[model samples]
Target: MDYNLMREFADSWGLLAMALFFVGCVAFALRPGGRRQADEAARIPLKDD
Candidate 1:
């Protein structure tokens, strides 16, 4: 493929793909009951075992 074609595809589709992925991650993080899991993970370093 030519450089111009590849660059055009990446400039549009690549940006859309990255934006969707970021939104999905934010949704997952903010979902119900996520807070408890996040808190437990935060305390992992303090655990002895």
Candidate 2:
């Protein structure tokens, strides 16, 4: 197995970029405003009538 090549690829930029994106997503999801927005959106699809 070429472990070195795999490590190099991850260390280049893709892994860091993905990590930053994931963190941003998590932060946004955890925010109070995000939670409220999600709750409201969820209810919009439900059958109320």
For residues 1-49, could you state the per-residue lDDT of candidate 2 as single tens digits?
5999888988987788999999999998998788789988899979587
Candidate 1 lDDT, tens digit per residue, 1-49? 9999999999999999999999999999999999999999999999999
Q: What is the TM-score of candidate 2?
A: 0.64
> Lowest-scoring 10 consecutive residues by lDDT in candidate 1?
6-15
TM-score of each: 0.92, 0.64
Candidate 2: misplaced stretches above 4 Å?
Answer: 1-10, 47-49
Best of the candidates, TM-score: 1
Question: What overall lDDT, based on C-alpha atoms, would model 1 receive against the true structure?
Answer: 0.99
lDDT for residue 20 in candidate 2, whole number 0-100: 95
| Candidate with the greatest lDDT versus the true structure | 1
Instruction: Say what the RMSD of model 2 is.
Output: 3.5
